[model samples]
Structure formats: structure tokens, C-alpha cells
Target: MAEPTDTAKTEQVLTEGNEAGVPRRDEERLKKWFIGSIDQGTTSTRFLIFDGTGTPIASHQLEFKQIYLHSGWIDHDPVEIVQTVETCIEEATKEFTKQGHSTSDIKAIGLSTQRETTVLWDIETGDLLHNAIAWPDTRTHAIVHELKNRKGADKLQDICGLPLSTYPSSVKLIWMLRNVDKVKKAYDEGRLAFGTIDTWLLFNLNGKERKLHVTDVTNASRTMFVNLHKLEYDSTVLDFFQLDPQKLKLPKIVPCSDPNAFGSMASGPLKGVKITGCLGDQSAALVGQLGFSPGMAKNTYGTGCFLLYNVGEKPVISHHGLLATVGYHFGGQRKPVYALEGSIAVAGSAVQFLRNNFKFIEASPDINDLAATVKDNGGCVFVTAFSGLFAPYWIDDAKGTIFGITQFTERGHIARATMEATCFQTKAILDAMEKDSGHKLAQLAVDGGMSNSDLCMQTQADLIGIPVDRPVMRETTSLGAAIAAGFAVDIWKEFDELKEINKEDRTIFKPQMTTGQSNGMYKRWERAVEMSKGWVDDSDDIPPSS
Candidate 1:
């Protein structure tokens, strides 16, 4: 036989399929695979569709209303958040199908949500008890102080891997149970369901019928109820918050990637598509960036900024102020990965502040052009402690304060300083992470809205004294979710299968300034931070609107 050529082999297979009464289109369809990711964020909701190669083929994003009921208070209508997710899925699916692909090609869906944004609902009625308390909301400021004074407060981080702070869902839930009449009533009656955004969305997305009240380890770690070691709810920690493990309807903790832990959609554009994976947004970013090895780190700049450094399979309790959190846990005998995290309360929101409040620029990206006009910050420093400084500083009384503003300072100066604020904080976090982990990072993987700006990334590289790597597709958060889902469904079987995903056209910003220059800028930032403290008194909370 003249050995069949490669083209002849393909033709023979197709001919055999046709002769076997199988449609050629169905055979061709087997070669195509897709995954969907729901990236529910603080300021917006997004649904992205990705091919097997981790390329985003279609996506849609929608910014929802940010309810500022009072100073330092932020709320989101739980109904609106879910609606936005459905709309994004519908729109993104339309786009996906428009590109000559079948919806059946979507093997599974994954969820990545803003962590610690607490949502409570009536377990029986499935009605929200109150507006969702966003993670950054400081309405629980008083509660945090009380929590810090409570017995076992000092041992909280050891148990749950989080400090006694306003950011965790536990504090917010405690505040509601004490203050909100309906919330307290529901709690007393055992009708209350407590969940971070993941649990809430999963509850709704899987349809109220299934009532899929579950959370991945990454999200559960932020609730301060999970024992970081066991990866399960800790009754001792629950008691520390005055929560009854029996009464409170806490979500079951599951792995980040699982075939059946998260149920299939009941109805929607992706009806019956299994939700095979879920992770907190920052964790998803790390997974998407392929930061699987210890000492590898990734930073996500959304409404806020979070830097997660993988510390291997075991959790490391930070002696520094950074948080200890689960990096990610893929199911099926895979051990949970741990991370040391440093959170900044304001990042892209500062640009929104300049655009809306200061009118310094018409849009976010415009600030980059404006900042470029100024060679440097012109001695201006903006301590964007809008609610309060988070992570290493944990300053509760600091308000947004601009220091070193002078007659020579312009909006461009302020813009440059605003950009530096995030970069400076990142440098602080990176330094602290190195100290805690005992390994110096040579580079940082950066993503999210703010990382799109070349100027900002270059500044980050200059300030941090390391290369900043930004992927060509900046939607690593969404991509991470898809990767998790893909893994669960066998679209990808192992970590090595992802080596080629999101690997092309990455821009690496290298250091452009002297070490002395970087140190000087950081020193100025530290001074500004110190000077901005104590701007808000303990009793400075604004009363909620009637």
C-alpha cells in the first residue's frame, strides 16, 4: 500500500463517520470546546466565554448601581446583582453563537466573585433580608473594634487566616444580626442564610429550587468561619463571632474545581450547563496567571487591589499584617494551595473618583494621558484611604487626604500621584510578602482594569524594582474561572495542559528609574500616609438614611 497521507487519513475518518450514519457536522463539533465564566465584581458583573486555548471569544460587562447609603457604607441590591449576571450571560452567549459556534460546545461554567461581600436571605422565602454589604463597607467599623476586644480576638488569624477587620463577612453579618430587625428575626428563627457573593450567586444561578448553598474554599476563607487547616467551618471561630453553627445557615465549603459540587443552571442561556468551578476573584486571577508554584504572585487591580502570593500547599499565618488565605483547591485528591494576601481598598476607584468627583479627567484611561503630561508627581501625594487603608497599614481612621499639594501642583500632578498611590501600596505589599514568605519575588503578574495603562504598569515596575508582566488578554480573572471549569470537565486534564494558555504577547515592564529614586518616592508616600491618619474619629460614622 502506498501509505495513506495525513490528509487521506482525515478524509478516511470522515468517510467512515458518514457511512456509519453520523453527521459530518457533529463530528466536526466534537473538535470544538468552550467554557463560560461569570466574573461578578464589586462595581460590575461580567460573563466571558473562552475556547479551549484560554482565548476569550466573547464577553459582556455591565456596571451596576453602587449604593452609598452613607459615608463609608456601600450596598448592592442582591436582585440587581443576579439580574446583571443573567444579562451578561445572555449577551455574551449571543455573541458566542453569532461567531458560528454551538452553545452545546460550552462544556461547563465557572464562577469568580468579589470575596467577602456578604449577602443574607431568608432560607424559606429566598428573599434578601437586607442589601448586600460590600466587603469594603465600613458600617461595621464599630463592630470591628468590639470584635478586637472580645475574647479569643487575638487568636482569630491563627484559626481563620484573617484578622479582625471590617473586610471580612463575619463582622458584617454580626452587625446585621444585632442591628437589623428582620435579619435578627430570621436568625432567631433559623431562617437566615449567610453567604459571600459566591454562595448567593450560586444559590440563585442554580435556581431557587436546588438552593445550592455552597462556597469554594477561596471564598469560604474570607468569611472567617473556615478553619484554614481543615478547610471546613470552625465552630470555635464561629463562637468567637457569637454565631451559632446550628442556627446560621452557612454554605458548605467545597473545592475550587469540582465536577458536581456546583450544580447545573436551571434556566438561562446556559441552561443545564454544569457549574464545575468557583473561586474568589483574586484567587481566580492567580490561577489564570498560572501562579501555581510557591513564591509566584499575581496582583489584580479592580475597584480595589489585591496581591496574592502562593505559599504552597500549607497556609502560612502572617506575622506581618497581610492575610493568610487559600489560594485555590482543585478537587479529587489535590491539596489546597495557600496564599499570603495584601489588599488595597482603593485602586481603580481612585481614577473613578478623579473622573467623577474631581473632574480631573473625563475617563479612567484619560488619567494616564494626563499623568504622562507631568514628568513626575510634582511633590503631590494622594493617600487614597477613601474608607480606610487596608492590609499592612490597616488604618481605620484615615480619610482621603492629598498631601504636598502646592501652587505648582496641577491636576496632572495629582493624577500622577493617584497612579503612584496604588503602585506604592503594591511595593509595600510585595516587600511585606517577601518578609513573610522568606523568598524575594523577581517579577509580578499584573491584571485587572488598572493594569491596562502602560504608564501605570511602568510606574509599578519602577517603584517595585521588578518586572511587571501583563498578559495580552487582561481578563485573567475570567480566564481563571474558565480554566478551573475546564479542568473539572476534562477539557484540560492537568496543569501542564495550560502551559500554552495565555502565554503569547505578554508585555513586561522593566525598571526605568534608579533604586534611589524609587526609595525616595516610597519614603514620601509613607510620610503622606502618616500625615493622613486620625482624620476620622471613632464616632465619625454617618447615620444611615431613613
Candidate 2:
């Protein structure tokens, strides 16, 4: 099934348009409209071009380095991250033109980024103050402990809809201002600018002239500064961190879908193209799946796994240990949609561990084939708590452990167990969502790298006792941003018009295992999880007595 050539497409368009006797301008308009999306993830950067139907026609992706200066400290070079984005845009644009499509066809662009990765820069010099602290970094653990015990700490979650944790960008910012001298000096001089990855990319993409410093509500909600109800920074939350807004130049908060909030790109292959849509990576995936009404849920299995369930127009403070955050804000008269999110810190990365660290396979996709060799886990269970578990458990002291291993345990069994680890966590999160929202989802929509495996999706369906829906085009994160951009510019005026986008060739996996058998396997996984904790004692990192 080769793609049609440029000559073939041109002929087909002209023949159809002339047969109908339609005006030339209308036909040209149909041929010249497209949307671009910049999907910046935790481990890679991508640029994708989409037509009005939401299919990614041309795209390029680049993986950047993850810097680990110390244990539990993961940082990314802010300069290198921005450069990779520029390169992706240029390369993707070249691909589009090679197919006889002009850059002018791309009417608008949208951006989605890894949320809560903190970056600081000089407002005047435009120089990065330090490396971007990634979301999973635990350097702020000590600070998080201190903040949790302070006065009014219990009220923080009610105000911000997030518990005090090291994942928030505000926590990372506080750690830098106290320890990093360069950041402290800039703050003292009133020249410091702070932002998440979205804000950083927007600043550079707009170039020095515009210097547009802003972030959308989806990204802002993760920073622990924005009030869930007000959609603006909360003074009480800022006071808890002892942050002075006068000293630090924070990015202005804007709606997720806006026509003119984020200015046009100042330079690039797509120079002067307006950026009209933005979302945090997970939120963008939900939009791409068209989870518009209440009760729809989507799970993204990327570097980490996230399950977000729509909680309708108002925020619901989770009593089941989930984070409450904004789903998307279309701006204008539309009310903001809120969601309950469950985050598992390790998903596809565990597969990478077996490939890169353990040498079990040469490529990522090989795990599916390898695991398929075995009928089941062979009484084995792997608790992939590499950096400890997340979501409902939130056990920081746990470590990766394998249980029920005998001489009979083959590599195939281990591989199957590894895949089951993620499925088990997803099931746990779904249960929590059901408790908080009081509605059991009929089916789960899934996307991202790991969802490509039929074995994994089937395992998910069996354990959760619900159908798992996967689309043929798995790049929904990019498509979600493209949808936002299209709506902002009137390329799409209503949600009903998007019903056909990415709707064909979808695969749905139904439960294959019986209820009793699935429940038995899940119970064993829970037992393993409980045993895996308390392995990393508080004093394990301390030097032994001389």
C-alpha cells in the first residue's frame, strides 16, 4: 500500500473539482489548509503535519539526552532541548515540501510538552540559568518533607488540587532558588523568569522580538500555583512556598485553546505561523481521543503511564489519592473541563530497562514477541518499582523486585511478567478512579508506545475486565494539539465535525480470561507489591559504621 504520488493527488483534486464546476478558490482552499503540532515528550521531540481530517501526513522525531548528575537527579539541557525542536520542525517541513505541499498549507501550529519540568532563564540576557529539572527527579524530597509539615499544609491540596510532592514545578523552583546561586542572584535582581517546558519553547519559538511569556491552563495546573476554581495563581499556595511574585517573573496563564494568546513563530521553516493551541502531553492525548463528554477515560503508556478520567466541568478533589487537574479550557464562553489523574512513574521505561540494562532484547518491540512465547507468567510476578511506585501506592521506599522465581522460570515468563506489571498498575488506577468518580468506565482508550502490542492490550483488557480501544494512528498526542489549533482558527467550528478524525481502523480488545482467573493473578501481583516495599531503608544510603 504505497502512498499516492504528488502528480496523482494533483490530478485527482483537479478532476473532482472541475467535474463539480466548483469555484477555483474553494478548491484551492481545500488543498492548502493544514495544521502542525509540536509534541514534546519526556524522552523525545516531534513535529507532525496534519490535514483537516487529523491524519499525520508528515513528521519527524528526535530523542535527546537525559542528564543524571547524581542519584535521583534527572535533568535535561534546556538549550539542547530547544535545538532538537528546531531541527524537528525543519526536517518535517522538508518532508512535507518533498510531497509537493507548500509550507503555506500549514495555517496554524499547536504545542504540547512534558509538564512540570522546571526551567529558569535571564529575562534580559535570554540565557538559561540551569539545566531543566525533569518531573521525576527526587532532589526536592527533603524540601517536600519540610513543606508537608508546615502550617496550612493540609489546605494546600484543596486550593491547588494537588498534594505536596516533588513532581510540581513550584517545588523544583523552590529547590533551585535556595541552592543554585545563579538562580538566586537573578531572583534578587528582579531579572529571573520561570516556566515549564511549554513556556520555554514558546519564548524561544517567538524569538527575541515578541518574547511572549505565557502558559496554558493545563500546564499551569501542574505547577501547584494556579487555583483550580479561579484559574489564576493562588496567593496562599505562593505564600506556603514563600515565593514572591514581584521578584520572579512568572509566565502569564492562558486558556488551552486560544486564537491569539500564543503569538506566531518568529522564525523557523514555518516562520510567522501562529501557535494557537497548547496542552500538557497527557491532556493533549485526551483531546486527541475526543474525550469530550463526562465518563470518558484515556491512558497514555509513555516513559511513564497516566490515566485521566473526565470529571465534568467542575474540579473534584480526589479522596482516593488521585490528582485533580484541568482537562482543557477552550476559552471564551466554554466552561473548563476537569479530570482525575493517576500517574504510574514507570511504564514503557521498564521495557527499555530489559532492553538496555538487562540485554534481554535488542529493540523495544521485541519484548512483545519474546513474551508471546510463554502462555503465562509461570507463577512469576515483577513489581517494576524502579524508582518506587506511584499513584495509589506512592511508596518511595520500594525497589524493583521479582518474586516466585524458580529454576523453571524462563526468560519468556519474565518478559510476560514485565508486561503484566504495567497492566496491574493500570487496573489499580482504574479502580481508584471508579471509587472517586462513582462511575465504572465501560471501556478504556489507550495510546502511546507500549499500546502498540496486542499482547499488552489484551492483558490490560483481561485484568481490568473491560474492553481496551486502540487507534491505528497512535500519535494522538500530536493529533490532540492539532485539533486544538484547528478549532482555534475556525478550520473546525464544532466538535461534531471531528467525529471522523482517527475513527477508522480502530482495534478493540475484549476480555479473554475468566473473572476468577484474572482476579487470582491480580491478587498475586498485589502481594508482590506489598513485599517489595521497605527494601530501600532510610539508612541504606548512609555509610556503614567504621
Best TM-score goes to which candidate? 1
TM-score, every prediction: 0.93, 0.93
**Residue-level lDDT tens digits of model 2 in 261-367:** 99988887899999999999999999999988899999999998999998899999988878999999888788899999998888888898899888999998999
The clash number for model 1 is: 0
Deviation in Å, model 2, residue 211 alpha carbon: 2.3
Write down the worst ten-residue block by lDDT for model 1: 21-30
Task: For each candidate in the order shown, give its overall lDDT on alpha carbons.
Answer: 0.89, 0.89
Output the worst ten-in-a-row residue range by lDDT, candidate 2: 22-31
RMSD of each: 5.4, 5.3
Residue-by-residue lDDT tens digits, candidate 1, 1-546 = 799753344334334457673313223332466899999999999999987677788999999999998789999988999999999999999999999989987889999999999999998889999999998898887788778888899998998898888889998999899889999999989999999999999999988977789999999999998899999999899888878866789998889999899998888878999999999999999999999899899999889999999999999999888999999999898899999999999999999999999888887889889999989988899999997999888988789999988899998999999989999999999889889988889999999989989999999999999999999988999989998987787666568657777788999999999999999999999999999888766566477699
Runs in model 2 deviating more than 4 A are 1-32, 535-538, 542-546
Global lDDT for candidate 1? 0.89
- Model 1 TM-score? 0.93
Q: Give the distance in Å from residue 90's predicted Cα in candidate 1 to where it truly belongs.
A: 0.6
Error of 1 at 324 (Å): 0.5
